[model samples]
Target: MTHFGIICPPVTGHLNPMIALGYELKQRGHSVSLLGWEQHREMVEATGIHFVPILSPRQAPQPDQKITSSRRMRLRHKLHRLKQRLQPVDHQAYTQSNGISALRIALAAYQHWSAIALRAAPAVIKAKGIDVLLVSETSYGGSTVAEYMGIPFITICVGIPRHQSSAVPPYMTSWPYQLALWARIRNRLTYAWLDILQRRILRLLNRYRRDWNLVPYTTLTDSASPLASLACLPKAFDFPVSLPHNFYFTGPYINDICRKPVTFPFDQLSDKPLIYASTGTLSNQASVYRCIAAACDGLDIQLVISLGGKGRDVALSNLPGNPLVVDYAPQIELLKRASLVITHAGLNTILESLAQGVPMVAIPGVLDQPGAAARLERSGAGKFIALKQLNAKRLRKLIQEVLQDPTYKDQARQAQAVIQQSGGVKHAAAIIEDVLDLAHISV
Candidate 1:
């Protein structure tokens, strides 16, 4: 049996899918362990997979103490500033400023996390005698650690696939997929700009590579595993762009059997058509929630808002609609009954909505969300509005449009058909095993 080491960001969106995949592999008789932050130990171990703490006690955030590190404090300040700047005022200016600020903040966080992982992960993997590694595409240090140890690893795209191509727009933008020459040129130029902006991250990675006596990665894609690169996105939901031969779209690694149980007030659900609204687990902005509540206030449908564990302190009673507000909702279960989903266009939520054949109106925030929303729109499954363009009146109009239109549901059902056949966690496990077998044969 292969002993697998799983590495991903500590955030819920990334961790959930990787853990689900790990759980599936363990069920198939392979041992699996997650190397992550100390705070995530309980959440990771709950899935019956072993958890390895990668950060020293000095570096890990303490539950009761405030983090006073200069880097962390600066990050918190940047986030606070970002939240303030996300107000729906000037659409064009907001988009530009937000993109730059968000990119800076993301790069800073990546550099910090990668530094810790590169320092600590090698020893843990060696100590555990891991046979194979499953690294998230977003976790910059996982593949580096595997290479330094001379082990095989597989790349898991927990979000949108980050494989670069001039034919496809960058993951951060809401640009549509167009095969025209001009469109390709625009995509290439954007990628070039991004490469320049990300020089610092590349330099940081190469510094470690040099010290480890490994070849430096000139591009981010060089870090992806040649054996296999797997994505949780369904093939049907993505743009018609060609990817590397090693890449496989294995649908979403959704293993509800291993997920943390959330206590939702199911009895409070009414007979009215359900509208599930969420900004995902990471984005718990009260302003966004307020706008959503205001838009659905007078509608006939019953609105259910999930604060994603970050909104417990939000005054639910003060929200415009008397919507059922929960810190966490049983999302997969709720989507089954939902007629419409208003979301931040997170891939997991979008895939879950499509799996249940529920249409959506997307208000994409940051990271790969805009790209996912673009694909959702291209697939004829949903409509999307830029977060900066979101307001009560506009969002309500789009919500009504999606709900009244039959085509959206029809398209969603078509996508649902593809998801049902994509083999999800099972397919992912089988692929990993196949890759492992092939690697062994080559050796």
Candidate 2:
């Protein structure tokens, strides 16, 4: 039997797609193992895959931030990361977030996590007899591991920028045309800096890689210069501008919805249009959730809101007569029934919402969320609101606009129809198998 090994960041945005891939493999009789933090054990276990826990030297990472959502600030974000790398701080205590400060924090964690893997991963690889290594696009040291093991590696593209860092070529892709020429030049310089940074990081990783007594990989194979990458998202939502072969656009790999399904309160609004408000797994902004809830109050349409992370305690109690207030709700189920989705613009959530043909009210909080929201607006599927201006009154107006404009739903439905027919998770699994087959052939 073939074995697949996965390493991913702890966040659900990273972990969930990996889990879906693992489950897909398990159903086909392949043994799967996951490497992650303890908090994600249950998520991996739920997929029926063997889970292996890994630890960093310390918790509470300082911050590794990058700007991914907006092309306007992405170069600036990279410059910020470069400055952090040049300046040495505690480094061990930062979470990998999307801002400059956050990126500074993650750089240390990325190195620390890889350093630990240097000793531990080889043992696991030998023990599992892994055939292929599917590393996260944003995962710290996974690309290096695949090289160290001499195994086939495939990176999953959950979003743009960081997720595309290891796989997509920097030179080939450029910022949107609307960006000023100076900004584009700056973005190019930032990309060059990142390219240098990635090379240095890989050099450090390769030292341990050689120590593992494994055959080393060439720079190109290990993402030395990225161009065109693969993803499971649908082409209708995201089309490849440059590298068509690089992306395996398998559509959104929604986690299997068969777990006895949680029943949300959407059944109450059979007549009025239904809207779902969610902030996704990370950056669960209470302010956004409360604002959405408050705006939704007294509306005739049914409202289901998800306030994830830490807790789902949405304090917007005593709603205006009609809106249903729930701390947590079945998002997938809600999206299927929803006419509109109020969201933080996460790729997974945004794609799922679009796949279901539900228009969006994108409230960009941090990171690629704003980009996802912008995509929605550009595609005519939704509107984007910066977190600073998000409020009930604004949301109420947006929802009304979405309802009045048939084109929004029509646009969303177009994307949904395309994604639904684009082969979703099953197709993604098939692509992975092909990559594995190619790996075996090469070996």
Candidate 3:
């Protein structure tokens, strides 16, 4: 049996997939150890995997009262949204919302992540332990640790495919360039900037590494093996990569492994089409909820609204003349039966919906959402409605048009077909095992 040490962010979005993969690996006789916040340790251990504690400060408290989806202090929102573009903004603000602490928490996470990897190195070397370190493309810890161990390491990208030069994940944007020259130029500039940032970050980490008990720098992502990593994303979306054949697409990993808490009372809906609504975890706008509620009011349809964790904030009244109001709905479950979806265009939500064959209305919030929303529009799977422009009238109108049209559904189905045929989790797992086999043979 091999022991694999993992370092992942403490957030639910990041940790879920990693946990799914680790659980699967454990079922196959391999042991996985995770280093993350103590808050999440119990959940990790519940999967029958070993968990190591990390010390990161707690994020500041949020507004004490429950807020309506679209309700916020107007003045505060204007200022906050303005800074969204200039992220890494005061980093302090990030704490209350995402449970981010001071810069030290981020630093602590890095240190904790690195230390776990470093400590695992002796186990790896002494036991001929891990065959290779498997890392989420977003997590720098395992890769850094791999460098120190001088062992083969692979990255498990959770998002869409991308080239080596990016400060964020590639799946955050839709890269369908009608103009090759423009696309190349964009990539080049993006690469240049990313390279500068990566180098800068590496410099900081390298200094902290020794003090934090980590090894020295390793090569950055390679064209050869740079990130010829494993991915839980499907093969259809994998596109043709510039990397080697060894790079893999593992079907959607660990996130789906858990039994979903969401459900829909299908019996309640009318015979008309279904529209699934969600603004994702970060931006669960009530505007979309109110608008969708209005749009479907008199129609013979079903509207399943997932307000992320803010359902109560949406204030469901007697009811939409045609829809059912639920605080949380199983997105994939509902989308499978949906004629249309209203979303915040988050990468995870959009990808999952696309995979389920549902067209969408993408209302992007901060971060990479706007970019993801634009791509959805480009893919013909959805249209973008900036949060600033979102309202009941506009949202209701958009829902009506999308529901009335067949073209959007067709496009969604086409994408879905690709996703369905892409040989999801099993396909992804096979690729990872293949990498392990190759690594075993090579070293």
Candidate 4:
């Protein structure tokens, strides 16, 4: 049996897919283990995979600050504010500060997590006789372990493809697939800056690699399963562009097999068309929740809002038609009954919605969310409203349009077909076996 070690960031979106992949590999008689943060240990262990802890560097605001949903600026939010602070100074000043600052923060976080992973991993690899390593796109340290140990590794990318390409807009920017001349030039420049940031990250990575006598990597992407880059998302979500030779679009890696079913009150709802809304694990603005409640106020829609992160005691008093407010919901189950979803355009949520043929109204905030939202709009599967422009009236209108129009649902089904054909973890497991076969690595 081939022993596989999977490394990932602690976030739910990243960990969930990796957990699913581990189950699939284990089902095939391969041993699977996961290395990540301590908080996720219970969840990982619940999957019956060996769990290794990666020490997380305490950021200024703490990790929980990031998960807290409020209007007050958290530490990371302060960094964003600092980024915007440079905007009025000068173009170059804003670009340099904003780009480098964000890159440094990410590098710092990755460096801490990776350093811990690198130190703890070799021993585990040796003990387990691990044949292959599966690394999350966010876990920079996993690549270093592969480099140090000379093991075959496959990158599991769950979200927007971070690799720079002229055909696609640089990640984090909400630019659509179709672009004009100026837009194209802007896109190129975005990639250029992105490369600069990646190079900065590479420098830090190489510093750690030096201790192991491994060669320095020129491109950050090189560290990501160079032999076989695996994208857990389907090609349908990405732009029409050529990918690298080793890149494999392995489709949505939903953890359906091991997914713990969440129970929701089925008897506590009206007969009105159900609308499911979530702002994701991080940053569920109470204001947005209130807006949604007001929008659907007295309307013929029963709104189900998932206020993610730390759930406070919420009284549904004075809300429109007594909307259901829960800390979390059985999202897959909700989408099954939902006619429309209001989301932050997280990759997993978008894919889940597509799989269920549920249309969306994307409300993206920060990171790759904007790009995901743009993809939804471009594909005609959903519409996006900027956070700055969100209100009860506009949101209500969009919801009304989505419910009334059949085109959105039709398009969602088309994407669903793509998702199904791409195959889930089963296909990924097959491809991994193929990679092992090509390498002549004995099981």
User: Which predicted model would earn the best lDDT?
Assistant: 1
Model 4 Cα shift for residue 151 (angstroms): 1.0
Q: What TM-score does prediction 2 earn?
A: 0.76
How many pairs of residues collide in model 3? 7
- Report residue 24 deviation for candidate 2 (angstroms): 1.5
Among all windows of 10 consecutive residues in model 4, the one with the lowest summed lDDT is 57-66
What RMSD value applies to candidate 2?
Answer: 8.8
* The best candidate in terms of TM-score: 1
Structural RMSD, model 1: 7.1
Residues 41-70, model 2: lDDT tens digits = 776786688897764422222211221235
Give TM-scores for every candidate, taking all chains together and pairing residue i with residue i. 0.89, 0.76, 0.71, 0.85
lDDT of 3: 0.58
Error of 2 at 179 (Å): 8.1
What TM-score does model 4 achieve against the real structure?
0.85
How much lDDT does candidate 4 score? 0.74
- Residue by residue across 1-443, what tens digits does model 4's lDDT show? 78888988666778888899998888898888886667788788887888866442222222222123442334235434433422221312222232334344544555555655654666667666777899888778788878767788888888887776676886677788765788778888987776676563566567556545678887777777766878877877788778888788988887765566566788887787999988763233666678888888877888998876436533344666568887778888888899899998888899899999999998876567777888899889999887768899998898888888999999999998898899888899998888888878866
The segments of candidate 1 whose C-alpha lies over 4 angstroms from its true place after superposition are 56-97, 281-284, 312-316, 441-443
Regions more than 4 Å wrong, model 4: 55-108, 196-200, 281-284, 313-318
Each candidate's number of clashing pairs is 1, 22, 7, 0
List per-candidate RMSD values in Å.
7.1, 8.8, 10.7, 8.9
Taken over the whole model, the C-alpha lDDT of each candidate is 0.82, 0.62, 0.58, 0.74
lDDT (tens digit, per residue) of candidate 1 on 132-161: 889889778788888878889999998999
